[model samples]
Target: MKKTISFITENFNKSSPDLVGGFQGFQRAINMEKEDIIQEIVLSGLKGRGGAKYPTGKKLMQSAEHHDKEKYIICNADEGEPGTFKDRELLLHDPYGVFEGMLIAAFAINASHGILYLREEYKYMIDDLKNALNHMRSLNLLGDRILKTELSFDISIFLGAGAYICGEETSLIESMEGKPGRPRIKPPYTLEKGLFSKPTLVNNVATFSTISAIIRNGYEEFIKYGTVESPGTKLISLCGNVNKPGAYEVPFGMTIREIIYDIGEGIRNGNSFKFAQIGGVSGPLVLPKHIDTPFSYEDLNEIGVPMGSGAIIVVDSDNDILDYLDAVQAFFKHESCGKCTPCREGNRQLLNILSRLREGKYSQEDTINIEKIAKTMKYASFCGLGQSAPAALLSAIEHCPQEIFKRRD
Candidate 1:
């Protein structure tokens, strides 16, 4: 049984009164030269937790290279992934930790303003977040010249309208600009021309919180936790068929078996584990044979799966794989922004195929079409939404062909 790691959740038990005010990381960040701060983060090997797993230090260095006087930091709190709620827990329990991270980033990149782009589903948390901001302001942890340093930064919360596509950085930026939530074409990536066409640094809630931990504990201590290729801990939103379904923070090298059987207390009802979906709905399926695979970016990548959104949804043997595919396909179909042809049409066709398979009317042609469209979306889709929408379907077709397709007479 793997023990729960406590880097990020170390202060989960502390109340807001105890958690708020006096951010040592932010204090230390303000005093250091911006270049040194970026170097420290680069050395820490902290990657973005918003599914892409991009190097946080590299992104920060790029943003720093751009000498735009009006740089901005956007903390992506829009936890739109179906099974991922780790960000919500962070915002709910340790909001100040998030704020400190944003401040540290802002200072590192000379960003004057920060925006917390929160999802509408989490609207109930708006008031609490605002109050936390006010408290930070009162303590001089936020607003102009924070902690009496020359570095000045402020943060505001903008409510998202529950659109899944807005989880993409460009789409979120468009919505913030009062436009509809649709992804933009790349080459002016967020680091280049983001949020009002100014240089912006967009990072997820978990990424920011982890940044705070790295700063608080120093990069040396942070690197001691996880694997060489994937250092530090990840907060996983473990759900579905598991006895213990909740947010768990664990080191990167722990295997799926450890996470499921040990941390999650194994599959519910003693029914036996069928397969687990690591990451969110778009994440690829991990079969029983691969359950022992270490839960790290490099290892999962070796198996052609991504460490997306830190969501692990376990499935039991009793449930039909087609039914699960139906639900997942339906979500992607509904969430397709229709901005691009591949995603908008591909998801629709994918859902249609699932429906036919469920009714026992699907053909080998339908199966072929699923692969064709899934590959099309993976290669040609406009954004991450369209690109990753076919992950679960592809995994199913590859790993459980007997279960997903109908037998020919």
Candidate 2:
């Protein structure tokens, strides 16, 4: 079996007391220039775990530079992506670590408030997270003048109604403002205008957890885990047709074949691996030919795959690829917020085509139209959802064509 390279999750235990000493580096950073804190994080080479893979340090630096306003820090704990459950585990077992990361982020950007945009499905984790926050407050780790320093940062958990799009930063902000969950346009990106139209820094659940580890252990130790191009560890939720379906924290540079056979213990019930979707539905579709492809931001990006949310869903040979694509299209069609023309219309069109194809009634025109619509969505869609929905079908057309169409042109 392939082994795991656990770094952030090394001390995972549900009953352990909230970490008391890990806040030292963050505290020390407060006494120095805010730029110094941002520099330390930049050196760590941590990318956004929320699928965008944007440099965490660069995002923090931009937020840090905006010193005139009350910036906000957000932890996107909405684990809504299909096959992703690593964030839920983090909150249940390491609530303190999450808080520590939020605190560090708040202090780094000189923000006074922080929010954890938790999904409603994980509502059971609220009490544990709340209790951990209350405990940290009492210990002077949170709330006014943290650790007896000038920095006074506080954090709170905000529950989200069950909406997949709410996991998006702008949509989460919209939901927080009591509006329907939907993504906002860019140019004034979330880093500049987010959370009540203020400068906000949003990160995924695993992103914040990893932040605590970097602050505590120093970025050098964290950097040693992954490659230079995509340094540091990643928490991947590996499921579907795997003998072992669970989360594993591993370094980058491992092949998909290694992750499936070694870490996931191979396909379930002796079924052969057919393909895998890395980074959830919004991520890229992998084929048998690409099994040896390294699992890293650089490697995956080169193949036009977005390392979305770190979810690896394996599909075995026994499963129906046409039916699978239909379900995938249905998800995007249902979850689409309908604010934009492209995502709303595009996903619906894809679903209709998938349905026809599933019924063995597809044509040459359907095949040609599929790629054209996917390209349109990719280029003209307003947000990541619409832009990313075409990945699987597009990959299928180019890679696994026989699996998608009943009659070829």
Candidate 3:
């Protein structure tokens, strides 16, 4: 089998009927009742790629069913995870697909306005996206009375200052509304009350592009690639200690061992693989013992891991696990929004504890305290950032307790 099969990552550089007629189908889709589109999405089994892995169809149905006069559809281009860049790859090459996905979503949710919250770090790709948006508008795929239909939809671009926390859906919504990008409290989620108190559909860049592909290929063809629970290919930013460190789209249910040894071309510098952090910094570490676990949402969640951001960082026996964990802790510490005390204080405490442990200024009591804080943040925090911040750190410590406590000072 091929290492990377391009589905969502298909090249958009060429001309084709599907390419130009992107919104033409969307216009026809507008004629269908909102439930029709939502049901099709449910049938497709495409989950969000922004780490949450929630049912995209459920979100669309909720927002579509809401009786709101004003509704919104937002593309979260803010791929702010530390090693995540698959979204950047899409916005650069497949801008039309991204817009097309957003357009289809707007039709489903009856949204007149759409926004692409592009990440500030990926500002270099802005011109390409703007050009694509213009090309789309020229073809009547976006902006004002799309494809001779009464439905009028327009999209705008808003760049975001790079903040890892804002990658959370609610936090991204808050950032788009001119507030500091922080995760909002639940009970009124994004679909119910989002972006100026209106029904909204907020999905990341990869999710949007995948929607377009699923529409073009139909759900039957799309579902053939992945597991029943997580159908369709996933865009993974495969990096770290891998020999071939680049983005690749592979089907779900493939084992991590295959991804590392085969697709990744094995560990770099001829070193043996120690572990890999699936899904980004917040994802769980894939120990050598668990390397055979498949990359499916239900399977990983059953083992306390998540398909968060699809950013996998491979580590070898030669690398220091403690240092890697320390860096992970520091990232969460710096990126914490301070809206929730557990995330704000727990990350700081974790980082300090790790540093002090390395300096031989801490005891076993501090390790127990760290574990207690991690547990607190998971249940006590208001949002996902705080809840998941301790994951990789705790895992690394669990696997390498002596190394985590080794004196470096």
Winner by TM-score = 1
Regions of candidate 2 where Cα sits further than 4 Å from its true position: 14-33, 407-409
Per-residue alpha-carbon lDDT of model 1 for 1-409, expressed as tens digits?
6699999877664634335434778767877888988999999999999989899999999999888888899999888898899999999988888888898998888888899999999999999899989988887777777767776888999999999999989999999999999988898788989999999999999999899888877899888989999999999999999999999999999999999999999888998888888778887788888888999999999988888898999999999998998898889989999999999999999888888888878787997898999999999998888888888889888888988887534
lDDT of 2 by residue, 101-151 (tens): 787788778887888888999887788788777887877877788877777
Better of 2 and 3 by lDDT: 2
TM-score rank, highest first?
A: 1, 2, 3
The sequence of per-residue lDDT tens digits that candidate 3 reaches over residues 1-409 is 3466777766555422245455444655677676777787889998888877788888887777776777888898878777788888787767777887888888777787898888788888878777777877777777677777666888888888889777787888888788998888786987888889887888988988888777766678889898888888998888998998888889998888888888989998899889888887887688898888898887788888888899888999998777788888898899899998899999999888888876777886897998899889988988888888888877776776777767544
Q: Judged by TM-score relative to the true structure, which candidate is superior, 1 or 3?
A: 1
lDDT of each: 0.89, 0.84, 0.81
In model 2, what are the clashing residue pairs, if there are any?
2-262
Number of backbone collisions per candidate, in order?
0, 1, 0
TM-score, predicted candidate 1 vs. hidden true structure: 0.97
Positional deviation of 266 in candidate 1, in angstroms?
0.9
Per-candidate TM-score against the hidden true structure: 0.97, 0.95, 0.94
- By summed lDDT, the worst window of 10 consecutive residues in model 1 runs over 13-22
